[model samples]
Target chain A: MNRKLISDQDLVNLYVSGQESALEELVGRHKSKIYTSIYLLVKDSYLAEDIFQDTFIKVINTLKAGKYNEEGKFLPWVLRIAHNLVIDHFRKEKRTPIVTNTDGFDIFEVLGFVEESIEDKMLREQGHNELRRLIQLLPEEQKEVLIMRHYGDLSFKEIADLTNVSINTALGRMRYALNNLRKMMNQKEYSYRQAM
Target chain B: MVQTFTQNDIIKALYHELPASEMVHLEEQLENDTEIQNNFEDLNVLKLKLDSLVLEPSMSVISSILDYSRSYKK
Candidate 1:
């Protein structure tokens, strides 16, 4: 069976019916978006990994218990699960996300290996890290909208519903997020030119 | 009827979330509107940059999840 031809709902059904690889395909298809969403929210690779695992654990339990009900919306559903897990974590810790590097763990260090030239890898890493920093700087509401729309691939309606805001509010937040990122990127470029 | 488009509408168009009829209007407006064109171009570039920023967890984490799935069969 062509995996691409199968829908997320089908994959969920297959997994529920005892096809193990179906779950693999589903997770593999969404791991990047899911992980990055969590990482951006928590801003720590270790905590992100923990929450990612817990998110899947909840997914597996829910599916195994025959409780999967969000038809044709697996990604959004899983993203919601991960988002809740991140919230639970923060609630337990009793603090908002902090940008800390004292753990000596580089979030990028845990990226899955890929074949690329050293120069290409360095350039890609630099650009991605820079973007990540800018994303981290966004105000919480704007950042959440940006991540859900851009990475989670959630539609504005879905985002509004998930975030308890109106669709226009979600769109407005996204607009702000992109504009803020653009300003920061341009400022960085200007600073680099000045230094050179 | 003349329809006005907001930056938010352009964003919805960027994400393909606009209604088809509104998309047609937005496209038509884009042909004559430099301001909207510039905003769209800037947002599109940033969106592309964002799309390329995919990050993945390590193989070990994936393995752990997979192994748990296998051993904890429903």
Candidate 2:
């Protein structure tokens, strides 16, 4: 069947009705967003992986028990689960999560790289690494809204509801996030030229 | 140029979430207003860059998730 044409709700229904591949399709369709959202928040690959698995485990159980009721809203629902799991981990660790690469873990280690020449690959990787670090420099609230809207594919209204802020507040956070990222990129380019 | 639009409105329109009525007027103003056009262009560039920053978990992690789902197959 043409799974790409299938809606998330249809995929969920198929998976619940004994089609295992449907579940795989669902995960494949959203793994990047789901995993990246988790990773960006926790800033740890191992913890992110664990929370991702746990999030899906909950999704599996909920689906099997016939309680998967968030029709037409699968990705955001899963994101909320992953978001709560990240929060739970932080609460248990008794430490606030910071948006710095203090641990210096290379997230690209687990990230997928596209086909490119050796030189091209290095340049792309460097670019991606720099952008990822810039994202880490954003404030936590701005980072959260950016990740939800950009990576989680949630609308501003959905983000506002999830983050318990007004839609305008969510939009403001996203604006700040993008503006900050743009400023950082420009500053980096300027410094590069100055050094050259 | 008849209505005042905020940066947030440009962002909303960029993400395709601005209401249709406002979008019609926003498009009109985008053609006439240089400042709004520039703001929209800058934000759009940033948005495109962000969109390219997708990352996926390792295959092992995906396998574990699939296995957990199969184990509880009803």
Q: Which candidate achieves the best DockQ against the true structure? A: 2
Q: What is the two-chain DockQ of model 1?
A: 0.60
TM-score of 2: 0.93
Task: Give me the overall lDDT of model 1.
Answer: 0.88
**Residue-level lDDT tens digits of model 2 in A1-196:** 8999999999999999988899999999999899889888888777788898999998999999999889999999999999988889999999977665544245534345567689987777677678888998899999999998899999999999998999999999999999999999999999999999
For each candidate, report its DockQ versus the true two-chain complex. Answer: 0.60, 0.61
Find the candidate with the highest lDDT and give its number: 1
* Candidate 1 docking band: medium
Taking the tens digit of each residue's C-alpha lDDT, what string does model 1 give over B1-74? 88998888988999999999999988898889988888899889999899887778877888898889889854
Docking class of 2: medium
Deviating ranges (above 4 Å) for candidate 2: A99-115
lDDT of 2 at B71: 78
